[model samples]
Target: MAFRAYGEVQQRTAGPKEIELSLFRQITEALEAVAAVETPPLEAWADALYRNQQLWTIVATDLVNPDNTLPEETKRNLVSLSQFVRQCSNRVLAGNDGIADLIDINKSIIAGLSGIPVSTVTEEAA
Candidate 1:
């Protein structure tokens, strides 16, 4: 989810509002991608690779852009990513984490959200 939110950000705007929106979208996408079921033979891995690459590109650019709407927010996201890069250490088939890092990214997103409170209790608690 974060990736999509980040992608929607339009740094070219007057106040970098567009870029902020993109960042928000990327955030949401990255967050949601976590729970999505991986259906083999359905190009799921490829899709994930494509999306992650896109997200990384935007994030990298934003990190260096002086016009970044929310510099602190961007940094926080990068820190989250950095943590994932370290925490996701493991073996892989073709230079990738295979499906392991997906879990890490999801966990990272949750960690990123740690400051936010979850106001509602779901059925599991009942």
Candidate 2:
């Protein structure tokens, strides 16, 4: 009985959208941490950036599924954005750019997912 209760709790916590939003938040927080340090650990920054890329890859894959309920244009846009994320992540990792842009993108998506007005979300990092 205890195991079954735990399973139910896990299910509640791991709903697809919830999981995505959680990951986005995690990535955002990680990036913020890296940015705060004088000399951030490359491994930690790489790990967080890679996780964000992986999340977008999953989103792109799901968007391409026939059973996906989103409108065609929406799916297309999301897939395009995912591609951009992949490219941008590589550039950021290569020291060609900062992670601020990536953090902004994730925060925007999180605001959308949370059904909150983007304007109301504080622009503060993390």
Q: Measured by TM-score, how close is model 2 to the native structure?
A: 0.84
Per-residue CA lDDT of model 2 for 1-126, tens digit only, reads 999998689768788888778778878888788877878887988888888888889999999999999999999988998888888888987889887777777878889999997766545542
Candidate 2: where are CA atoms >4 Å away?
1-8, 122-126
In model 2, what are the clashing residue pairs, if there are any?
Answer: none
lDDT of 1 by residue, 1-114 (tens): 987765456343436444444444454354345435554433544554445555555666667677766668767778567445443432332544555454445344443444
